[model samples]
Target: PVKDSTAAIGLTILLFIIPSKLDFLHAFDKDPTKRPTKPAPALITWKTIHEKMHWSLLFVLGGGFAIATGSTDSGLSTMLGESLSGLKGLNEIMILFIVCLFAENITELTANVAVANIILPVLAEM
Candidate 1:
């Protein structure tokens, strides 16, 4: 229904803000049928925020970025690109299949972003 990017942003902002104003956290109460009668305490407490955050995911994302940067700096992406250049004459669907198969296998071995960083340059060169 959103006609433009600005409307989409506005709708997203409204979705986020309206729920807090309406005591959305009450849905987490132990008794599902009973509505919370009292005003909810501050939702953004340090403990709550810390518990909700994925610390492990942060480390993985950081590692992925580091790997991407290292690969680019070491010309690894370029080397990979050159190696795959032989497949340039393949049919589009076949190329797509090969790329998907390669991506799936590589992603199983490492983080997806890392595999993407390593493979995107190769695809671009091709």
Candidate 2:
């Protein structure tokens, strides 16, 4: 596997440029259509990307990061950690079970990264 970031990115660029230049993907076309006498529209364009982008999901994730930062800066994570520190006396399996249950429930309401960002500092303290 390529471990270098630059090499990985270079490989990705080559894959994209090579296919576009050679029309390599046409080999896999399942829909055989008549050849057009006139030019056809490009498959992807700036307008297509703009309309297809999920702007709301970005904002939701950004908000989640902001919340995580606020919680850490405001010592909410410390407080939460202190509250859960009592669990040190509990069995490791019980602690793991509780964490999984909490994560499972919270994940239903938000993105996984959002939950991780919010919970990481608290877990670190614990």
Candidate 3:
């Protein structure tokens, strides 16, 4: 292969010129113990990782889903849809744009996934 030949020629040139001109290989081997070493960081164990992580993520997600269901079932979403539809003779596109803005604002106030979980079901009902 052309790649292998090129690499072989390059290595041959390096071996000849470097050892003959500067002798770098001899100098590097003359001192080995004088190099500095960095200490390794402590490894994480399963027990430590489990202890450090809070398990409330499941509860938060489940609660968000429940809240979404309740909000939809109570006709809040329908009211929101009707109210927004009255905004200066809003069309579908304008209503969608406003909804997107409100959705972004809610996501900024709360965590994004949690807000999305709540919003998606409500949006579907609307």
> lDDT tens digits, residues 54-92, model 2?
998878877787777787789877777888789888998
lDDT per residue as tens, model 3, 1-126: 579769977875554444232333344464665332433223433466579967788577666667666656787655665665455466768867987898888866655665676566545655
Model 2 regions more than 4 Å off: 1-46, 107-111
Cα RMSD, model 2? 8.3
Give the alpha-carbon lDDT of every model. 0.77, 0.70, 0.61
Model 1 CA deviation exceeding 4 Å by range: 1-45
- Candidate 2 — worst ten consecutive residues by lDDT sum? 34-43
Count: clashes, candidate 2: 0
Q: All candidates' TM-scores? A: 0.61, 0.55, 0.40
- In model 1, where is the ten-residue run with the lowest total lDDT? 13-22
Residue pairs clashing, model 1 = none
Clashing pairs in 2: none
Runs in model 3 deviating more than 4 A are 1-54, 87-93, 108-126
Could you tell me the lDDT of residue 118 within candidate 2?
A: 67
